[model samples]
Target: MDAAVNTPVVVDSNDDGTVTQELELEKMGSTLEEAIVETCSMPLENRPRLPRITLSKRNRAVVKALSRMLIIFLEASRDLCETDLILFGTAMAVCRIIGAKFSTAGRTTAQSSAIPAWGIIIEERIATKMDGGGR
Candidate 1:
């Protein structure tokens, strides 16, 4: 939908200062709003945060690498129309998002049926809730 989006979810820390999360996702065809509502309706204790990663300092580098891969794929597939390129890009983004949502210790690929639009909204809701910026 939009060019940029962000979503965040914060899991309250336990007595040991660890956050545990149990995300519940609906089937692929469901609306993004519905997915967000479901995620929000869950109990706060289920949204615990995993331990911070020392290699997290390289997060930006990882993103840059992925972006470069997208660019390379686009360049290599130039015979395809602009629409195809756009769709491919969106697909990559969607995959990235799914990975973020289900990932426990490392990145994971999301099924293509999960629309990017819904992913954006989910991310926004998570960010808002985590940051205490919900409307």
Candidate 2:
């Protein structure tokens, strides 16, 4: 996926003659929701199968509520920094890319396989963040 094409860029000019470019990930949330819905609606045989994971309705409701709360928090924060926006954009992009890869793999392969690349990438990111004290 081309970030330039898929992501929306917002340019902010400060009074100090500095410019900041922020990528808005909220816009991609709706598209990701649509993709999730479409993936869920696929025929049983066409969809990827995970053996042990299950999200209960209550858990899902909680997740949805928390997601809404997070969005609201992001909106209400006047001190929102570029790093926050960048992290959100990166997270959304990773999710979408992983989802696309899984969907493609489901269509091309007979059996579901572990996403080692994405898993390793996420682990490394987490480790880096931890090492940097959540910089």
Candidate whose lDDT is highest: 2
- What's model 1's overall lDDT? 0.37
On residues 1-135, what C-alpha lDDT tens digit does candidate 2 reach at each position? 433222433323432322132223344444444433454455535643322223543323323433543554355446645334433433333344223222333333433344567887888899999899668
Candidate 1 lDDT for residue 107? 28
The per-model lDDT (C-alpha) reads 0.37, 0.41
TM-score per candidate, chains pooled = 0.22, 0.27
Error of 2 at 101 (Å): 3.1
The predictions' CA RMSDs to the true structure, in order, are: 20.5, 18.6
Per-residue lDDT, model 2, residue 13, is: 41
Name the lDDT value of residue 14 in candidate 1: 41
Q: Give one clash count per candidate, in the order shown.
A: 9, 0
Q: How displaced is residue 100 in candidate 2, in Å? A: 7.0
Model 1, range 4-119, lDDT digits (tens) per residue?
Answer: 12222223444332222323112111223333333344443343222333333233333333344345345655464543534434333433333333232322235653458889
